[model samples]
Target: MTSVWIMLVKKSRAILGFAAISIVAASCGTNAPQDTWQPKGPNSKIIDDLQRPVFAVAGIIGLIVAVAVIYTLIKYRDRGQPIPEQTHGKPALEITLTIIPALILAVVAVFTFGAIFKLAKTDDTEMIINVTGQQWWWEYDYPTQNEFGITQPIISSGQLVMPVGTKVLLRETSRDVIHSYWIPALNGKRDAVPGRVQTLRLEADAPGIYAGQCTEFCGLSHANMRMEAVALSKADFAKWVANQQAAYVAPAKDSLAQQGEEVFLNQCVRCHQVNGLMRADGTPAIAAPDENVWSGSAPNLTHLMSRNTFAGASFDLLSKQCRDEVWNAPSDVVGTKYLAGVTEECLNQKDLRSWLRNAPAMLPMYANATQLKATGGKYRGMPYLALTEDDISKLVAYLLTLK
Candidate 1:
């Protein structure tokens, strides 16, 4: 029995040592995009400030308690010694410990409340954007703000774009299950519950892309429900807005892209929307996703190539090298690189083709005919589109012109 106990203790120590080492190693990592410790905005800085001292106090208290417990165990071990007389309690020691923790908690509460109030301040908001979450993607809609030159509503998906150094308030809500909107460098996570609008304040100190994820456990592709916040300078943001609000240009006559437009009208228009698209009868080509999609909507792909990523941002539209060029570019040049969009040479054809060939094979979704019945014949995700290779080529060509 003693041998077994000794072996168990050894194994426990080994496991603890491994866990400690792993945690320390993880903390020392660089280029960790979602690292909460690295604050890039005022709101996140508030959180970082509160966390640093709280961690310090907690670490110190934990170390002292651990040391005291270890000392008592060593001093009172039953090693052929008679049991010592037990006392009822140490009133003074108990009172001291209780008072110390209470005082610490009081101080922490004061700062914590202050930070919360600061984060919740909306009176100073300079801009507002509506964020809506669904099964595996996020949609951003910028309301008309005349002061900012936004004359009409602009809808985009896959990434949220905002001006740097601006107090942008995001009014978030979900269409289906609850989801969380988070950009670790910008602010804390805010839950997007169905039928309830939640607000989160976000500001970026510089122009760059900050990655985020749905902290809430959603559905089938919950892990793949990622998001990105792109911060651009005010001037650059204006340019982007103009581009987004610009009239959609039709494909050139008799081009392969024109053929792709026909294919899109025949096959893809049911779920996707391309603003200003005209039908053969000269009527507007509007999508009817509410009837076909479980979430009642799909991403508006009016300017699809303007975004570097697609498919809930789980896949990149650009090849690795081109993507790196945009992601790693200097702050001042990042916007230019991003605005360049996906060129023919930089397009990631393999993944796009694979996705078009069979979407279910690429990502887990309740998209099969049998499974879709539960959604009332509505797809929870993009269903498999058995497009011929030639059709896919034309579609890709047409999509690139969206910019």
Candidate 2:
């Protein structure tokens, strides 16, 4: 009997050890790109270091309580023994437990205060980017980013690009409802509220992609409002800036791409803009999106193919092979490989074609006729364009040339 009891204890310990190891391994998962446990920068590191010790202390306290309860249960088990009369609780023991918890809470309070101060220091910001949240997407604009050898203003959606080893401050606001921007690997969430600009400091220690989402429930398509921060090395970031600022070259005359350009001018020019394209009267064809879109503007597609993802970073633009060369490649090669965005042979045409056919069906958008009627005839996202298969083919050809 004694040998059997000892063996049972050993088995229990072994099982617990295996469980602990498995849990640790699972916490370091590679598939959860937005796992808060994986801190990639200073902001998230502050949060992790502050909370982990507190969690450890709490776990220790819980284990001590559990052991005490188990010991008492075994020691006081009934074995045809006399029942003890009920008595008043021990005042001293109660006092001790209360004091211990108060002390622990007090320690937690002090460390929490220190972390708040450390996290609040954002004066060292090297760049400022404006983030505007709307019904279904986020738009990022570099206001004073002269680094990366970029002298002109840069605007982008779906992907937020910043140079590695620098502090990028986001001045965030909303045009419609409230939305929260949270990139777990880099920093905590900050709310984007209408009429108020909130600030959050972001910094990346290395070059990679950090995925984020709108955590706050803002609208019907809130879950689909995803974003990615693409960190690039200095030289590669400069190359990206130069590419974005390069002159817009029109498609060759009489080519299918030029025909698609004409189609875009007819159906898409109201909301989308290809920079430097002129109207028939030679007037600059500035897009007037307020007439069609609810947010009063749309994503600029001037260098559309220069980006990797589309439709709020919810879809991949490059083929699997090219995308792997960017996403799964080594750090030294990531920047150079990603800069070569969406080549013709590497374009993912199937999804893009479907998206061009019916954008609202692909992504949740308040753009159907009934919803538009209810919302005073304003569309909250890209509506179905009812494009023919031939039109979709031509438009894809033209958009491919925008790079």
Candidate 3:
């Protein structure tokens, strides 16, 4: 009997040791980048506060439970005696158990509520960026900035540019369905509902690029609806704003770019707008009305080459090594490399060619010929304008000059 008990104890100890080793090995094997957890903004402070106390309390509770379990196991181990008396539960013991847990919960609730109110207070925001969500894309409007002091709103898409360390308040809404705007490194997710304007606060303590995706599934390409928030130094942000506000520069006369512009006006202008071009009488030409288009917002490709990626930042603007080289470096290095704007060096020509050929096919969308039959055969997101190889080349040439 003694030998059998010794063998059982040894086997149990071996199993426990194996379990511990497996847990440690599994934890070490996780390969997610360690740099992701480091937060660099005001909103990150809220994340820190919320996680810290919860983890601390959980750690304390876990330690207590572990110690109690070990003590009970050792103390109550089988001994050479009859079974101990099993008594009914004591009222005092039950009351103490309930009261302790309740007290701990109350304490947690108090701290959690305090933190919620602190983070929710958005009274002192200096600027507001109106973000409108749509199917498979995002549109940003700087309602605070006046264009050349003319008070015309500055609107763009795909990239959300902001100055570093400045508190930015986002007023978000959706056009068709519910969508969520979430940049995990910076803050919590905020839902953009169709009829209501929801507000979220964002701040970047350092100048760098942060990637985001739509948390709410909207349509065919919800997974493809990605975005980037670029935090720049004040001066660089001002420069970006100036460049964005600058009047469109027409391609040189009689160039391939000029031909591309003509092609765009003839075929693409019905859904897109190029700022500088006008009618022969020097008057603005209105885009042909397409009621099927959502919010009349297409990505403003003014500085197309200036950005690192396009088409919702789903594809890399540069080669894989180039992107890794930039993103892996520290903030200072990344800021310097990406600040100038997108250039030919970073352009993904293959994907660009594919996109110019047929955008809906390249990226999934509900813009098929059958889907558009209800809307008088008009394109929903983007049309597959039947362009010859020559026309595609010309259009791509014109798009490249947008920078």
Q: Across residues 363-395, which tens digit of lDDT does each residue of candidate 2 receive?
A: 888887565675678788888998999999999
Model 1, range 220-269, lDDT digits (tens) per residue?
89998999999998999989999999998999999999999999999889
Question: Which candidate, 1 or 2, would have the higher TM-score against the true structure?
Answer: 1
Best-to-worst TM-score order:
1, 2, 3
Q: Model 3, which residues run further than 4 Å from truth?
A: 1-36, 59-88, 146-152, 279-281, 288-290, 372-380
lDDT (C-alpha, whole model) for all candidates:
0.89, 0.84, 0.73
Query: Best candidate, TM-score-wise?
Result: 1
Clashing pairs in 3: 305-342, 306-341, 306-342
Q: Report backbone clashes per prediction.
A: 0, 0, 3
What's the lDDT for residue 19 in model 1? Answer: 54
Superposed model 1: Cα runs more than 4 Å off = 1-28
Better of 1 and 2 by lDDT: 1
TM per candidate: 0.94, 0.91, 0.83
**What does the lDDT come to for candidate 1?**
0.89
